[model samples]
Target: MVRDQREIPVRDRLLLAGVQLLEKAGGGDVSTRAVCDLAGVQAPTLYHHFGSKEGLLDAVVSHGFRQFLAARRDQASASADPIEEIRQGWDIHVEFGLQHPASYAHIYGRVERGKRCGVVAEVEAMLLQALAPAARQGRLAVTPADAAAEVLAASSGVILTLITQPEDAVDPGLSTRVRDAILDSITTGSTSPVSSGGEVTTASAAIALASTLEDAPTVLNDAETALLRDWLGRIASPASSGARI
Candidate 1:
């Protein structure tokens, strides 16, 4: 049943109006007057609910991001190979960008000087969560945090590039190619030729041990565990050669 618009909360109505106008505008300029009219509220009501039109738009973008994250979490498979999960995550990220170009642009394409999008940290955290499993299995060449950063940077770049290209000119294989290259650079799987000898590097061992420590109980106390992590970090660091500068 189509309930009376009056029954809806003013805040929700404003958000719905803002998102509709934003999609209609192709993520371009949207005037407060138009949004207020669409929401059946006066200018002051919008301000009361959202502070300003810009604030409303930020809320819309945030809402879209939350929905995406929830859906991704629901669909994610826990038992899948970690590397494969990362690959699927990359594909999903790209697909979301393509399907919601305007919203995606707001998240990653539009940039302000020295300002970071709030959603980026959450995205990176998700990547870190996915990489933890690989780290535990000695499949990661770098720490989970490092790998997450690399993947986020590369994937965001790919999404922006794809979104700007003309529909006919978009490269079908670009996403997959870039995804594989970045994955290969950061991961050392048992099936990978470089890992054929079943030998683990000092850094890889340190990474795996550090990751596994989180899954099981340890005899060390908080301070000792912290010190141990510090030592492992030093071992895993590429520049930790004990050289005095």
Candidate 2:
């Protein structure tokens, strides 16, 4: 049985309306008035709750991401292998973007300078958590942070590309190829010997150390911690280390 949406606060009701509209028409076709009309709230009430249309959309995206993370957390419980877990995460992300094209577009497709989506950071943190076991087991060939960045970028690129294609025409193999390519770059192959070379040792050790840093107790402020991650990323992947979160 469906609960009555009106039973929720007006603010939450408006958010729910925005989400439904986004799913139906995508954000490019949605408007503040449309949301208010759908939500059965006056314009003033919408403004009072959300400040602006942009604010409402931001809230909507945040709400969607929280739900997304909860589902991911539940699925993660069945995870056994960290590297395979990363693959499953990529599949989950692609599934999400394809299933919720509008929400995924709002979350990632609208890029701005100096202003990034908070959801990306949250996802990265989640990725790092997934990478922790791999790092400890010496399966990581890059710092967990760096690996997270690479995987996130690759998955985002794949999904965004697929999202633009006609539903029937989208090639599922594209995502798998790209995902495996990025994973290959970040981790040694299943049969390959680990830490057999100095470079491998440096990268893997850097990953293991970086993974432990979150709980290792450091006096570093936010800035210092950020810079420290940058340095570790250099040791892990010199080419793409400078890419910011």
- Total backbone collisions, model 1: 0
Evaluated at residue 77, the lDDT of candidate 2 is 56
Per-model TM-score on C-alpha atoms: 0.82, 0.76
Which candidate ranks first by lDDT, i.e. highest? 1
lDDT of 1 by residue, 1-245 (tens): 99788999999999999889989988677899999999999999999988888779778877886788679768876645778889988888887778888877667556889977766777888889888888877777788999999999998889889889998899979999999999988876454322345446667778888998997899999999999999988887866422211
In terms of lDDT, model 1 sits at 0.81
Clashing pairs in 1: none
The candidate maximizing TM-score is 1
Q: After superposition, how far is residue 87 of candidate 2 from its true place, in Å?
A: 0.9
